[model samples]
Target chain A: MTRQFLRHGWTAGLLAILALLFVFTKIIQPDFGTSGLDSLSRAMLPFAFATAAMAVVVIAGGIDLSVASMMAVAGVTAAVLMDGAGDGMTAVAVVIVLLVGLTMGAINGALIVITRVPDIVVTLAMLYVWEGVALLILNGPGGSATPWLRELIVGPFIVPWLPRSLVFLAVCLVAVWVPLKRSKLGLSIYAIGSNDLAAYRSGVSVGRTRIAAYAVCGLFAAIGGLTLTMSTGNGEPIPGPYLMASVAAVVLGGVVLGGGKGALLGPIIAVIILRLVRMDLTLLSVDPNVTTIVEGTIMVVVVMFGGVLAYRGRHK
Target chain B: MTSETTMFKSVGRFIGNNPLVPLLILLLVLVGVLEFMRPGIVNERWIGNTIKFAIPLAMLAACQTLTMLTGGIDLSAAVAATISAFVMATQVPIVGVPLAICIGLIPAIMIGMVNGFGVAVCRVHPLIMTLGTGLIATGCLQVYQRFVIASGSVIPDGLAWLGTGRTWGLPNALILFVPIAILIIWAQRRTGFGRLLYALGSNETASRISGVRSWQVFLALYMLSGLIAGVTGLLYVGLIKAPSLSLVNPLLLPSVAAAVIGGTSIFGGRGGYSGTILGALILTVLGTLLTLLQMPEGLRRILFGLIILTVTTTYIRLTEQSR
Candidate 1:
């Protein structure tokens, strides 16, 4: 039991944080269990997917500043395609949006590899380009959340205690994340991120791993975009500022920034904690801006504590 | 044939040795293009206006270039600038302008100190520390605004004059800019502190092994970045004649772009600010060209992003081959 608990490491701490926030929120709202959690889960889907996207890219030793931009593109693309489409076309539109996102991600990876530019620089530029693409696609927002998509996403609870959003979240984890975590691609990602030169010497093909990482990121970002579209009932032109929030959550989740270590689930939990922080502030009727301050403080202070722990472990 | 080959080789060597020359040439070419597109647009007045707009941008970018020298970035630079400008503007009506400005700058310095402490003493990544601090500062500003919004803000007269006034075909801001520019350039080349930044960026472990207190350098460096950002903010408010919550937020990415375009390597230990100055001018010119076309905002941004990518890619390729 002790060994297993030790193996869990930061995940345990993250869960503790999540639980603390949950209880605090529960206190703030007596009706928090059923309706509150359902709405929160609905709100969380986009961020969860985005967090997964960021986790994949960061684990591969690269940062994708364009994740939010990619989501905007995907969201707007789907919004445009699904506009007044029937059920069949709506499904097809979803597939096309996924493909569009994957293609964009592939292009980012190729550009980074071929240009030999730093990932941050490449992604930063792409952030602008993709945002432009999003604006062009949906110039003034609107056009999303068709009846089918709305029902499919948010209509009825599939299970007694669970939300449809959580169900979709589980599907993504079980169907996509777990398999990726177990695959050769996952191993390659860790290899390159930890030490690319050594990995190259040992025949890991750093370029391919990076491309795969970003491609996966693009797909997940598309999922986030889709969820956002359905949940909000329209596409927004602005790439929401999920990039920093996602990064903060990633760090708080114990995904080492220089890369190569972390669980995908850790960030998902951290996202909930972050959302709860906002929820708590909202419930308290304080200024909306304090939420950002608390979140930023939490991220920095948590990371600092972790750093101190690591330093001590090193000395020991 | 031998003479031609030697001439080509010598030209390549000259470019490789002084990378700033090509960037300067590019700026001139961009100015010429803008002139061709609109005719009579690249005159003394045009020069004055372009330099005026580019001044705040380049000053803000100094925060980036200086930090990039040490393989770190001050992501909070924009936020610090916004806070300074907003605070100074709001407080000017209550306290006198000079005192308001000084008080406004204190937050930026405190942010800088926190960034320094987090990054240097706590060993947090500079990106994370500045980002966190930037958010905190923004939050604090919002809190401050709640109280001050009832009172309203007034832009300072001296700043307004410095931002918009012209004297003998030159921007009045130049009076302030010339000394700042000279000091930055001179310090980058002449100061021991500048050499220390290069040394630390090149090899932090090696520098520490040689007894350089890395923390001291980082604390000073980040604090300086914060100070520059704060001053740029104050100047920017004067130029735009507006103070909002996100007054300088838009400059954050462009400042990074300017530094990178000037050939400052993001990974650190290479490049200089002279090229960055040219890069800022080129970007301003490009923005002007895009506005002249009068395309949709979306198309404008697309072209803008495309142009920046093409320029940086081409510039990097050119510099790489020369070396």
Candidate 2:
């Protein structure tokens, strides 16, 4: 276990960077310990979920460009249902939105597998389709989440100091990621991602594993959408920026885009780091335009660092 | 009966040998359908307009095709083009048109060189590398908008003439596209660099072992993509007259879709620009038809997505069967 942890040292490095950023933020804004922490958690939650969604697909040796679009679709669906139906239908609305996400993801997987098309191409096409569907559902993006639904998702849980988003994230780690990590399917996903041909030769069902990965990706994306709706109490059809941001986060998290590497912890920490950077920029009163430049620079730097590490490992 | 069977077999063989044949046929069929649906579309003015709109897309598709031919992609192509346009539009007032155009293209080429260096030297994935560069380009545009140049600047008369002016009753953009197309076709068919790209994309290790300078070829291809994007952006500014940051943003996906629809393999090593030309024409006509039908924006996007998906899948299946 120690050897494995050492092998994936980037995750540790990222966690340290995240800690530093937190400390720095606290230093810059001394009162950041109060309401700032809650807002920070709320801002980090959606992107954390998005990074996890991309990580699952990347681990299965696939890329889903449609994830942000899926989030938008889910968010809009939840909002529309909540607004149209009464408070009593919140649970049903949540279930239906999740199903929508699953269906979209499954469609992405099915198209790629059945047609023998590249994952990027299939998902790129689906990105457009989902974006269109989101726009069609809510042409102008005017819907509200139920007050109770918002309270359940973002309201304080158990104690005033404990934000609900943090609790939700912890539950995800314990209930979803940990169990999935140990399951046969999860192992199969990693196997396929590492080398699908080899896995197929060894009696692993590559198709099934890939489909499951996409389904899980969709599920997480829906969760992200739900969180976004709760935090903002609204929905937006345009998700192009979020799509790129999630990909950036996934890459920054030390997850190889080619797949079969990295851990969930890395991406979670990476998301927090990214959120903190944005917060810092805002606190510093930097121009919003510089934010894109910073994010892009970070993505390139992380990718180049990974590239150098891989090259060194290969040469050695 | 045997002779007829042999004839049919030969025809199939011919199409399988030349991928562009079916694409050309499809383009013609689409044009015919459009003409039938809207008689006015058959006129020279309409044809000229369609060709004009297709010119920049075709060039962008060509950019995509060149990169794909070398087993890579440039998601920053549109952004590069937009930046080039922004530079030219902003500088034309101060400097003359010729100097401004040259200045604009320099940074565009630089963007490509950077992308190439990352993909070749650093060995980063093309998707992520280009995406990062694209983000950087967008950021630059945002900064430029906020600080340097005012938004919605008009194109100079000289540039505008290049965009919409006619030469011998043919649209100037179309006139420009023909020579560029011819040059690319000639290069791909007859140039050593072109053959190296195909070989490198086909099997990098084999080509490397056989003395192909892989890095040089990658750099050249990426630089060429950037140069083409820059030129396309200038033409796009001419077409639109006002070049804003978002002016050419929508072209990014369509350029990729055009290349794929043209039967250029995304995995690389198996396609050409001839099909891409037809692909651009098809999309331009499809856009015209969609507009004529007066569809809602959402519905139009959905249809565009469906067409891309269906066409790409069909092309892949057909090629696989042929192989």
RMSD (Å) per prediction: 1.8, 2.0
Q: lDDT per residue, candidate 1, B164-217, as tens digits?
A: 889998888888777887888888889988888888889998998998999999
Distance from true location, Cα of A8 in model 1, Å: 2.3
Model 1 lDDT vs. the true structure?
0.87
- Separate DockQ for every predicted complex: 0.71, 0.70
TM-score of B chain for each model? 0.95, 0.94
Residue B52 lDDT in model 1? 93
TM-score of chain B of 1: 0.95
Best by TM-score: 1
Query: Which ranges of candidate 1 are over 4 A from the true structure?
Result: A1-7, A155-158, B1-11
lDDT (C-alpha, whole model) for all candidates: 0.87, 0.85
> After superposition, which runs of candidate 2 have C-alpha atoms over 4 Å from their true positions?
A153-161, B1-7, B150-154
Clashing pairs in 1: none
How much DockQ does model 1 earn?
Answer: 0.71
